[model samples]
Target: MTRHLIPLLVFVVIVGFLWAGLSLNPREVPSPLIGKPAPEFALPQLRDGGNIVRAADLRGQVWLLNVFASWCTPCLEEHPYLVDLTRRNLVPVYGLNYKDQRSAALEWLGRHGDPYAGIVVDAEGRTGIEYGVYGVPETFVIDKLGVIRFKHIGPLTPHILNEEILPLVRKLQT
Candidate 1:
């Protein structure tokens, strides 16, 4: 009877922990790199394969580094917001094409819309690893001095753009 009771108690404890975790939002997973300098990379441009884009080149201006892949369905949901932002001319948005074939990416862009100021091909996903990307469609807001200001883990929504991203970008610009 005593041995059976002990196992029951341990199972209850494990179940309690699982219940607690289920209540937490997965999108709120804290990134250790927040407020730290963005990891730098120099990757070939998607549009012009011969050209390279260095992360360092974006210093002295507030901008966004959007990690996406041609295959990511959620990225399609986020693309329209990015396109609107680009048309508004609010801030320069750079794309990190994570681990996707160049032709596929180009075709995807053509099918949807190219919202990036420049797109960098992360062909091997090494840069994505350096940026601590948990998955595709992560976005980073960097300040004028090149520090990562905010990270949004999922597809960008109009509410998130207005409530969080735009407010932060405006604050950083000044």
Candidate 2:
């Protein structure tokens, strides 16, 4: 009887773990880089390969580092919001073009709208890995001192921008 109960107890433990994992929000995945200095990188600008954009150059300003790829479908969904954000000029938005061809990225931005103040190409995705990017469409909120404050793992919707990102940006700016 005790031996039979062992399997049932293990099943219950497994089910409990599964339930906890399922209830957790994927978007809220905690990043280790929060409150830490953002990884330093100097990548070639997407449009003009001759120009280099360095992470250190963006210091002393609150900015958004949006990691995206031309082939990412969710990035398309978030493109309009990013464009609107750029138009508002509330904060500078920089694009980290992750593991994508320069032509494709440029064409996609042309078709959608170029929202970034500057775009840096990371064709091998090495920079993305340094930034702890799990996939494209990840966004990081870097504070004035070049420290990462927040990380959004998915597409940016109006609600998230209004409720979370904007508020954080405002606070960080001050």
Candidate 3:
């Protein structure tokens, strides 16, 4: 009887684990880099390959680093919202063009709208990996001192921008 109960106990434990996982939100996956300094990088600018944008250069400002790709469908969905956010000028938004061609990135930005104050090309995706990017359309909120405060996975929606991102930006700016 004890031996038979072992299998039933194992099944119960598995179910408990699954239930815990299901209760958690996928978009809110906690990033280890939160409260830590953002990864340092120096990548070529999308508009001018001759110019490089360094992570260190952006100190003393609260900003958003949006990771996007031309081929990512969610990125297209997120673009207009980012454009509108830039119009507000609450915080500077920078783009990391992850693992995409320069020509395609430029064309996509042209077709939609250029929202970024500056865009850096991460054609090899090395910088994205450094930032712990699971996929395209991830965004990071960095404080004035260069510490990462928040990380949002997936596309930005009006609700997320209004309820979460904007509030954090406002607090960080002050």
Descending-lDDT candidate ranking: 2, 3, 1
Positional deviation of residue 20's Cα in model 1 after best superposition, in angstroms: 7.0
Off by over 4 Å in 2: 1-21, 26-28
Q: How does each model score on lDDT?
A: 0.93, 0.94, 0.94
Tens digits of lDDT, candidate 1, 1-174: 998999999999999999999999976779888999999898999999999888899999999999999999999999999999999999899999999999999999999999899999999989998888976799999999899999999899999999999999999999
Write candidate 3's Cα lDDT for 74-107 as tens digits. Answer: 9988889999999988789999999999999999
- Clash totals, every prediction: 0, 0, 0
Full-model lDDT, candidate 1: 0.93
TM-score of each: 0.87, 0.87, 0.87
Candidate 2 per-residue C-alpha lDDT over 48-122 given as tens digits, one digit per residue, 9 for 90 to 100: 999998999999999999999999999999999999999999999999999998899889999999999999999
